[model samples]
Target: MKRTQARFDVVGQLGALRRYARSLTRDSSDAEDLVQDALLRACENRSSFEAGREVRPWLLSILHNVFVDKTRRSKSESLRIKGLAEMSPKQLDAPQDHSVRLAQIRAAFMKLPEEQRTALHLVTIEGLSYQEAADTLAIPVGTLMSRISRGREALRSFEQGRDQTSLKLVGGRDVS
Candidate 1:
């Protein structure tokens, strides 16, 4: 395919890519940066793209790779910032009850392991089929299912104020 056509095809999927990025980063500025980085990488490596394959998944795979790389690089910086923020004074400000609950859920969701979180987001939020999400993540369908299951269980445990071990040991047997 010609360069112009390939760029056009990629641009067509930009909205979906941005949405996926936003889901991954949870910050608009960071998500936009991620999308831009992914697009730049995709354009630079366009030769690797197969002409007959779908573009959205390819773009998504690139976005995921970019996110992983950024996350690895920023791990220490993030920790430092988090530690500094924790050392600061606390505010007594309170949000609305509904907003507070939503914030709690979002915080719990963010606390999930990265793999499980990605799997759940792709399947549930992105409305991707199991096979499609598996393809995007480059994992087996069973592995993807396992991630989603674990992610859901973890979120449930967070809401219920229970640990995963306790949840699995109900009725004098491991239910997991």
Candidate 2:
């Protein structure tokens, strides 16, 4: 019974972790990986999770740290592999007719300034309220709003060619 209750508590937070990971990665595969990593970290540090404190936010904070670490490593490795001068818009925008739309969407997201992308991921994709996202990012609410607006505008303009305009939401909504 104790083990079952522990599993329930962890599984209950899976949706939120998946949402946050999706926002960070913008791809299902990467999101799954991020979630797995976060779960592993949570399990490894279980004793640190204070009793009565919110576990969901604590797990997400760990995820955020993991993302930052991975991003930094990726950036450094990319610089070494591609050479700084070779990493340009043209080079990154290689042709792909079969997956043009997906490529374009990814390219657009990659083009966004990091702050804007983070804001969009947290506020729009993750369905986090502006205040909550701001708290998570440790940014001022005004700055967070500005980043979200810029990110949305950029995504909209980039995907202007597509017939679909509405966001395809997944998971259940917290109506309350």
Looking at candidate 1, the ten consecutive residues that score lowest on lDDT are: 163-172
The digit string of per-residue lDDT tens for model 1 on 16-122 reads 99999999999999999999999999989988887677888999999999999999879978999999999987875466877988988887777776888899999
On lDDT, the leading prediction is: 1
- CA-RMSD of model 2: 28.8
Q: Could you list the CA RMSD of all candidates, in the order they appear? A: 25.8, 28.8
Worst 10 residues of 2 by lDDT: 167-176
* Candidate whose TM-score is highest: 2
Total backbone collisions for each predicted model: 0, 0
